[model samples]
Target: MSNSVKTINPATGKVIREFETISDQQLQDKIEKTHEAFLDWKQRSFDERGALIRKVGDLLVENQDRLSKLITEEMGKPINQAPGELQLCQGICHYSADNAASFLADEERDLPGGRALVSHQPIGVIFGIQPWNFPFYQVIRYTIANLMAGNTVLLKHAPNVWGCAEALEDIFREAGMPENVFNVLYIQEDQASQVTEHKRVRGVTFTGSAATGRKIAAAAGEHLKKTVLELGSNDAFLVLEDADIDKAVDACVTGRINNNGQTCVAAKRFVVVDAVYEQFRDAYLAKMKQVEFGDPSDENTQLGPIAREDLRDNLHAQVKESIEKGATCLTGGEVPDREGYFYPVTVLENVTPGMPAYDGELFGPVASLIRAKDEADAIRIANDSVYGLGGGIFSEDEKRAERLARDHFDTGMVSINGYYIAQPNLPFGGVKDSGYGREHGGFGMREFVNSKSLMIAQ
Candidate 1:
């Protein structure tokens, strides 16, 4: 495990730097030290924790330019989006700091015999497994909330963005976090098992593929430990007959292409009712085809390379399979003869059940177009998948559309007449194959806490 950790430049496919994976002894030491920190941290007042957390947010804002550049270099995120991502991280920190105390404050409950209070108390050290797509935002969403709740955190970020992981540890330390209150485990996947099984670790939160989430959950389950698994999604964006075509088209394009189409919540499937299918098809196709990929460092570049070569290969294979299974490519499908790990913006039509592009996630700049017979059929088509993470409905009547979104949409989150992503004050998670548990909003602060009940004698 000594030379196993490598951070690669996804845009150029170059070796950025290779680092040593910490030994079992080193990992054990980190675990112990972090556990020790949690003992003291758990006793601190919410005000004290909130103050420090706000400082973390301030620091992120101050360092946004530098850190954002690093994010782009490491992950091929377009320069314009990198700063936005960091700013969102700053928002998470502030949101957790400002609202966590109230969110987790002791609640007085009426008891039959005596007065009872439900207190949210820190459980212990929580381990996090984060992905690289939204490098800083992903970690901040979970860690900030937990920190405000007085739980020490351990993060094992994706190897491709290890630099960002280490930078986070430094940021926490700079913001006056207690020694070992936040830790970055420079360990591989196998080493993670050890961390999960460690007796001191209380809960685990993972944001990545469902396949990996299963492994982490199974490992933690064996110890009867709590786990929050926020996995992948193939979110459907439905275009109803009455939807504003102009608004719907723009939302669909942005929803699909944001984050180079690597986002878990990015709309992967477009379920349009037949009334406006042709207009939707033509507009979506033209806009999608116009997308261009260039150096992420370029401010003018609208799109960048996929995170890695294998990811690009996987996306192309999905497109190829969909085509072979009778789906027609409306736009970009073939891999471009480019230097970087890039795939052009693609749109597919005639996508149906059983095809990869239809049932599974494409995970790139590829959009699946599924036709529905009508409004009822569109809802059915949207909810026809195993994933229930996020979906959208566009309609002229906001009230009626919201009803469909609230009552008919089976996804954990839905949009009425627009697109949406993770918001700091909103509970973000999904049902079904997208994984279980919630993050963001106020709920995240208590996810790893012990909600102890205290009944006082009258």
Candidate 2:
């Protein structure tokens, strides 16, 4: 096996840096140190931890420009959008730091024979297996919560975003956080699997595809360890008959292309009511075609190259397979003759059940248009999927849309008529094949903790 990992600049398809993967002994030492740190960390008051976490957030803001440029260089994120990711991370850190004490406070409950106090106690080290899509945010999303909960964390980030991982560790150190509290392990998959079975690793949290999530969950389960998996989704964006066509089109376009359409909850499948199918399709296609795919460093570039050459190739393969299966390529289906791993914004109509565009996530700047007979049919179509991380219902009637999202949408989250990547105060996670457990909105602070009940006889 190779002893190192290389990070390539997706925008130029050139190698940026190569990092040496740590040996088994080094990995063990890091894990042991982290567990040692957790012992003292869990004893600290919430205020103490929060103060340090807040400092980390400040550091993120202070270094946003430099870090944002690194993200663009490593993963091909558009220059305009990269800063937004860092801002979200900053928000996550401060949000968790602010609310963790209240969220995890001991609760009093009345019992017939005794009074009960339910306390959330910190577990040991948590192992995080994160992806490259939102390198900084993905790590912060879980790390901050775990840190606030008094548990040290070990991150096995995607190879492509290892640079971001190291930078985050540096930030935490600069913030005066404990040396072993936030560790970035530079190891391969087999080593990661071994770490899952390590005696020190108390829990595991992963974000990636459903297939990989299943494997991780199974591995963690065999050891009787807790696991939180936030897997992929081909989220359906419903366009009801009463939807505001212009607004829905614009939102869907942004949703499908944001993060270059590699997002788990991005608007992948467009289930539009047949009443306004032609109108939405025409307008969406025109706007998608206008999106510029070029250098990620360019301010005017609306889209950027796919994160890796293999990812770009896989996305193109899915497009071709969907087209072969009778899905009509409406626009931007061909790969451009560019130097980087660039794929044009694509739209596919007549996307039926059997096609890749309909069944699987296209994980790129691609959209699938599925027509429905009416509002009921649109809802039905949206729910016809094994993965239900999130979905959107666009309707002019705000109350009706909220009602549909609340009672009818079979997903973990829903957007009434707009696109939102994530919010600091909202619980973010999905259901069904999209994985289980929740993050953010204070739920993440408890995922790796022990909820113990203390009873006192009256």
Candidate 3:
């Protein structure tokens, strides 16, 4: 229970900066101010809101270099990939600003005796608890949509990315957003719990682990408040009997190691049919072994250190436990003898249900390879996990792959013949243990809004 938030550079394992947490009284004042701002904000026209939101996107473009560097320094995302995260954030803001009006406009419907109108209206202040994995994108994912929906926002970002949070607040300010329309909370866990209960806070949105998402859902449920949770995933990538082995290997390698494999939707499991298992495994392992790990800022570094020492330790522990439980390590399971919190790109074979590598998220540069009897078994293995966030299918038969992805993937989203990340126009989120609700597309703009029905008789 420290009184201040300290950020560390995972590349050097050194403290970057420290900022003091706000007092309880300050927290209360900020909440009140945000709610007050929401009252006026919700009354403004969508065009007005959209104009301001578009400015936020413009600011992101203007400051991409500085902000991307900040992201790499704070969270250990490779410098090359950090800009891509901001690029996604920029798209989110622009998309929300452009489409939210049409998405939230009133709709005319036929009623028993007359016409009915359904209008989506903003509630009030929405509180978001986001992770550090994609600092800018995570915040923008929720914030822009809520703002476009006319609700003021309060963010309790991960402590390790407090600097990113503050930078966002500053960006909103510079974009001429009214005071207190978007606020960042520098508070402890206990304080966050209290904020969730505040009467002014109408809804909650969280992105993190399933265990923590449950706690958030429970806390919000006690008050009968609305919530949207986007939790973790051990996503699977399938290789069918007629799949393109080289194509699958290239995509799978990038899918697992991108962001140094810290992505929640990153492909963790490779389920290959017996026909292609050996080929896929051999090529996948060879490429994974060649991933260059170094300082995040280095242009040639393909893999950077984990976000923190403890996360690296936890990832290594999972690898060890999986090895002890009968999984075979093919490459890069050892922590490197380096200065930073570096773990090499690892590949594990023969992963089964009882092992951590099979059942849980590694959250680092580790890949799990599972052999399947055939395409049916591969599909079964992919759906076997409690998480259903996102998964992939690789096959030469596009029609068959599409059929499986559309009908049997059992996840919020699926990729056909390759891998993909979050898209501003597509829905994101998961089911079962991966948490509930959807973001991006038009769904996020309506997640926290009220749809009121009006009956009219002529």
Span of 10 residues, lowest total lDDT, candidate 3: 81-90
lDDT of each: 0.89, 0.92, 0.93
Clashing pairs in 2: none
Cα lDDT tens digits, model 1, 1-458, are 25477777877888898878888999999999999999999899888998988888888889988998888889898888888888888898888888987999899999887899999989999999999999899999889988899999999999999999888888888998888989999887788999999999999999988888888899899999999988888899989888899899899999988889999999899999999999999988988888888899888887888998888999999999999999999888888776779888999999989899988988989999999999999999888888889999998988998889888899899987788898999999999989988999998887998899999978
Deviation (Å) of 373 in candidate 1: 0.4
Tens-digit per-residue lDDT, 242-324, candidate 2: 89999999999999999888899899999999899999999899888899798889888889999999999999999999999
Q: Predictions ranked by lDDT, top down?
A: 3, 2, 1
lDDT for model 1: 0.89
Cα miss at 430, model 3 (Å)?
Answer: 0.7
